[model samples]
Target chain A: MVKKKFAETPNFTIRKDFRPLDVKEKGLVFVGYEISDDKKTMNQFLHYDQLYTIRHGWNSPFFIGLLEGKIMGTRCPKCGDTWVPPRTHCWNLDCNLQRTEWIEMPKKAKVHTWTVAGWSGRSSLKRLPIILVYGVIEGSKTAIANELHGVNPWDVEFNMPLKVVFKPKEQRIGAITDWHFEPADEWEPSPMNKEKERIKKLVEPVYEWVKTLK
Target chain B: MSRKVCIIGGATTPFDYGPTGFESIEGGAAECVREVMRDIPDFNLRDIDMMIYSHFSVHFGHQLSAEWIIHDHLGLVGVPHYRVENGGNTGGSALYAAALAVKSGQHDVVGVIGWETMDSVSQSQGSEFIALASDIRYELMVGGIYPIYYAAMANKWMRENKVTEEDVALIAVKNRNNAMDNPKAQWYRNEHRYITVDDVLNSRLISYPIKKYDCCLMTRGVAFLLVTTEEYAKKVNPDHYVTIDGMGLSSCTIRAGDRLNFPGWIERYGPGYPEMTEFAACRQSAEVAYKQAGIDNPLKQIDFGEIHDAFSTSEAQIYKALGLADSENIAQFIRDKETYLEGSIPMNPGGGLMGYGHPVGATGLMSAIEAYYQLAGLIPKKHLSSKTQVPDPHTGIVNSHAGTGTSISNFILRRV
Candidate 1:
């Protein structure tokens, strides 16, 4: 009981009339931590994603331009630079101006970087495959994330020419990417693998932490 | 131009999650400004000097590439303005930037407004998107989400200090009750009546130690603050005011993934380590504000105010960091209800981010505005009319955290 409580939320000490170290066997390699209610410890694990907790911005395109396969980052008038995912101010450290004009992101660009994801179970996606990437676009200060189709994750070469493809409007989820990435070639787009993303999201973290245990 | 600035006026709209957008945040900005104008009756919006517009979800609003969409809609077009984004800290950073603008003598009257609409995005994607704000190269790129970070922090706190998971729950119960008096709060009256420590310990795991009650609900809203100089304060009403006493902003590494001593919430207590995004942020930011206000003992000196209690774990760290209660002994403070709005140092009179809503972009200024009203005794009857009401809580401070280990600011407001 004494040890498990401590393991649950580690770092700060509470003042207690009964010190945990006083009565327990101190040196059994966390014999103290295992003192918590073993059956109940697992019960404390929570699912914050569900039961309506925190959520962020939508993914679908806000304007017609994005739905029509346009890169629509904002452009600041004071700096007169075009922001691909448009911005209200010049993010330039020195120039501080709001009120930007919307501009089209240059479609013709090379792949800056890429990651392949195998699907995990979630809404509409069941072990589906997907590719996520970021790169320099013409006239944009920041790189944006988009879905990559048609090419294998291993085949995703750097600086390769690619064009944006809007997802079917019915498939939109109000996210930044109502559209995803597609090879400039009109060949069949790959159905994203969700397994890789699942491993990245679920397994990698505990795996890394456990390595330090020994 | 000394290294100091003053708030001239401020504004906000009723907060909700996602149902509101940039237009609504803009609308809140408009309403808050209109309220400020009504209160001042002298300074006109057109007469204000410059502006900084902040929004964390402009992309979701589909207004990402066009800040002008809201900038122009807000009617402050031709003067001077820029959009600001620092993930979650954009709101406070906006005020911090506005303060810099004032001290630099760049803008005489600056309107700093932040807004967000989260429902605009689907939930699963929201987690990944927010996760992106961390050191994505290392943190998000690997798959750690926000609560995981907090869970890591909670893990650290429990390990170092002889504390229990129930301690984290106590914070949630206390904060939600605090939200009851807050008309603008989102989770003011939770359905789970009379939650207990055992209940918290048995709840579903969100990265562990972070139960459902321990986390905050999502909501939409906008907040605005107008700031100027002490001289300018005399021009705006002079009496019902709160000066920017000692404002300090800093950013730190929020990812525990990087530190061997990641559990060092107690160990990493140091100077010049600015705003902290972790639960520790409230404490660090409070330390700066307390020092600036010449407050040697925050619990005894500074009056009650609001903070970014985005998670119950965060409030635990804030209370401990602020010295309102020792980390281990925090559960007692909740029983005393000393941190509530009607308690010894009424906290979250506006219900905080947990109750009111966590709009990310507008949070900082809203915390400041709540402090402003508390100090000015300008609280509405709803917050004051409750069984929990102790009437006016004057002279307070507002502290909030932003982004992946980005910036935190502490503002002290006093009734003039």
Candidate 2:
């Protein structure tokens, strides 16, 4: 066979190795790899930028409220049920649903449950043995799972009063991390709202289809 | 208008923790398929009319289009082949698809393979690869690794049920002991096969409430299954004992918060808490499977069980969700060893994910394989091992779940 100036299979013929310079930008992952000219040797390095913007959509206002040091919610005009995550739609399955009205939520809530993690992942591991509490946001059926800080681990109890503490202005951002919960001495107890609309039945065909699956 | 589906034969490679020594995905898959073929006398690749491969991550093995790679390696060029990726339950989901293929009458015989090679990379990389299955926008962005999510669920379950670390430790101990009888299981040869509650409680914690032993080992392996029609099965193996009677697959909302709103749920643990074990998907899938199998009560109807014990806590949660045990007393079931091989309904006779090892994509079919062995009376003759085998298993249920209960598939098999 005649030697050609260029081979048809580019991957088969490894060229000179190329080195990738590090990029310092946040939220971008860069992976580097090199193969020898003989296509016999290879090395690779994976670089990850863990931060990224998560679109909150209709829930953006909820995060935005934290930046303003105000807890916000959306009340269903139809059934008076409120969601602290600030949903655009009503939870009420009945009645002609309308756009929910944005309402400022009470800063105080009660811890429904909590866990003291002796371990965590990359983002939270730095604060090892972090305490996470699932709190029922006061005056709303919505509950938020957030970091419970500034409280003794042994002192934490179910249904204990917790108060949301927004980060300072310099630290504030439109994210779930902009606030954390702390033990609160005084907060009003909200009236028990009618059991937030229970999804009594699954969507048709799904429930019907489950039993008839091939 | 579906035809009856039967499992003619199946095989699973011994699940090994890393450095599997397989060069390519095709190599492991082809070897697994060959092993399955060996189980069915006179069977060959040509008998398969179609193939379905289940694999969750192409990143782990640095391989893509796995079905094509597998089919080419098997030398089944003309075989209609495709791949299914459903997180951890990929195996069972693909098998369900294979059953549908046979039931559709388009093909009487189909091959299903679940293969994953995570040993190609480091353990941390494996964790990251699996975490990709979670909701990237919410769960993954918020410091969520697999163990943290499961730990959070365990925290809620333990708090609500008044269960302690020692109470849940029995699950890990039972499954590990059972693995001693299974040569194919991961810890079958370990000197610490029988870990005590103290061992688990004192072990290094991955995420609080989940110890090292509570989690399934990061393993690499492949499992294969051959599904054929009822008539076709009879012709091939007149004495074949197990036939897949019913299969149910259901998915809940990917967001943990939304999962709590699944129909008729009591959100005792608040948002994201119920998703851990009370996966509406599992309940829905079990309901469908039980109804189709004519099972009124799984606790009594199921002779044995093979559950997705990705974590010991998950198995306990599944036990309650499946109605295999009551919610308030799940710890008692474990404490009493009620689900042990010699218990009322022996579960994970072959050690389950905890013992058999979890190769993600392959774990579901591994459950299927264990259930098949139980229904077919293939217990190996070892005292402690045979005890894990139920006395006479005629009906069984194998549960498969993925991504913190995002996807669930249940298979109901009977020794007909």
Candidate 3:
């Protein structure tokens, strides 16, 4: 086919109903179309588009940790403040220049606040009733908003204990949705096991830690 | 005591999706300029020293140099044109820029216009575009949408205070009814003017505790305001003008979590609570503005307010933040109708962003234009839809915000 200057791409005026004629044969992306109320003229635009990629520097550990079935946040060594969905530096000005240390959050968390989303934006339409909940990780100082799953909406309550349920290893991706939360049953901690668990927690960093070399 | 700035005249298109000429957004811009010129005799493109245009999410229009497009469409090619964008607060920011231009004496008269074209795409696409204003990495990535975030904030406020869904619904009802009188309002023509609290309560849920009616609609419209030096105002209409008495701007952390200072509720829910000081942007802005205007008390000194009611719950929070009411008495302050037009201090008499329609970029300018009408006492009888109007209002405030209480820009307008 001979490439025509400005003639290769054909433009079609929209009909009164605001529907476009078959342009699939032209191999053009249907960008957008608009119609006037008087129906005198209808305009449509089509063109080549670009998909941009997002880079997560200094925050890759948070995403990588998700794929590893771990929830993580950054801890300010100076202020002893914990941030989920981690940051690279301390939020407080007083703790200036204090590089944040990474810590894997506890699997156990509680619903701090929540909302049942019946509608969502274009990106998450298929994930309706998003059951978005701001959860307070058991050992963290802050709450992180994430999807809550594996329970009826009406059963959810404030301060309800929940456990993280990770996606299967093969299907796991380094994203926030890699794991969701479910209700946790009450545990009557036996006195003997409680002491051992406490000792183990103290010996460990309480959360997995990672750092970047300067 | 810098040079004073006054709004000589303004115009706004009736909030609508479409029915324009081939120019699309440029057509709306032309209409605004034409109408404002018609409103002010002898006013033309030649008098404008500078132009400030407010537009959010340029991708929605699929155009660049939008400010120039509007400027050139008005036949002012060489005129200095600048674009001011700060999410939903774009309009307010543009107005502030215009005021600064006149105050600096760099421009004797400036034209500020705010226009948005969300209707150019589908509603879902529009929502997607708006969601970009939020913390995309954290919020949007996990399926968090714009209205859902507002809904969560509403839930937090209700849980902290003993506010009921009914109270929030009352705000929607009042604003929807108020829109009935505002001929330019988006909901004015619809039967929604008679929407009851139950109607809002029973409406389809967009997010829990926040029904569809509780949220503002994504509208497409344009609003323009002309700010000129006091001397220029005298040249135009000496006796009739609204001077920008005071202005204030402030911003806060993007993370909503950082702003919650509610210890009582956070302890109970294992989460942070909504603290008055946490949402300090608006309060700080209102305080600086009132102080600059030489007003000691805003609740008592200001006659009316055209606040940013992007969501119903935001109105209540703003009331507390602006010192319109104390934490203990805020619910009563709103519930008692003190903010009604007939009450002590009228709020959003023209329905606000809720009833008036929030075309993002145009909302802040819409508030200022509404205040201009109230301060000038020129609000057409037909457009005066509030249950009551502040009698002979001398001063009013226009509150504008970006994200969920992110950036705050306010201007106190007084009849000169």
By lDDT, the best candidate is 3
For B1-416, candidate 3 gives per-residue lDDT tens digits of: 68999998887888865542323677877787787776677676788889899999876877777877778878888889889999888988889889988998889989998888878777877887788887777777665567777766677677676677778888888888788887778887444457888898777667777777888877888888889988878887676689998999987656565454323334433453344223467877887898899988888889999988887888877887788887677777878888876678888988898888988888899899888888877676427543435579998999998787788888899998
Q: Identify the runs in model 1 with alpha carbons over 4 angstroms from their true place.
A: A1-214, B1-4, B18-25, B141-144, B188-203, B260-284, B327-335, B381-394, B403-406
Candidate 3, residues A45-147: lDDT per residue as tens digits? 7653453456677787888788788888888899877877576887666788589999988899887777777677876765665677877787666567788
Per-residue CA lDDT of candidate 2, range B299-397, in tens? 888888889999888888888878777666777877888888668988888898889888888889888887887777666532245666678889999
Clashing pairs in 2: none
**What is the docking quality class of candidate 3?**
incorrect
Evaluate model 3: give its lDDT.
Answer: 0.76
True contacts kept of 3: 0.49
What does candidate 2's lDDT look like per residue over A1-214, in tens digits?
9777763542436222222455354553447787879886555655445534555766766766777888888887877877765668865556355689888998898876555554444444445555666677887664566777876443456688988888897676556777888889664434433211111111122234335434
Over B201-247, each residue of candidate 1 has an lDDT whose tens digit, in order, gives 55544544455567766656777788887777777667766677776
RMSD of 1: 21.3
TM-score of 1: 0.61
Name the candidate, 2 or 3, with the larger DockQ value.
Answer: 3
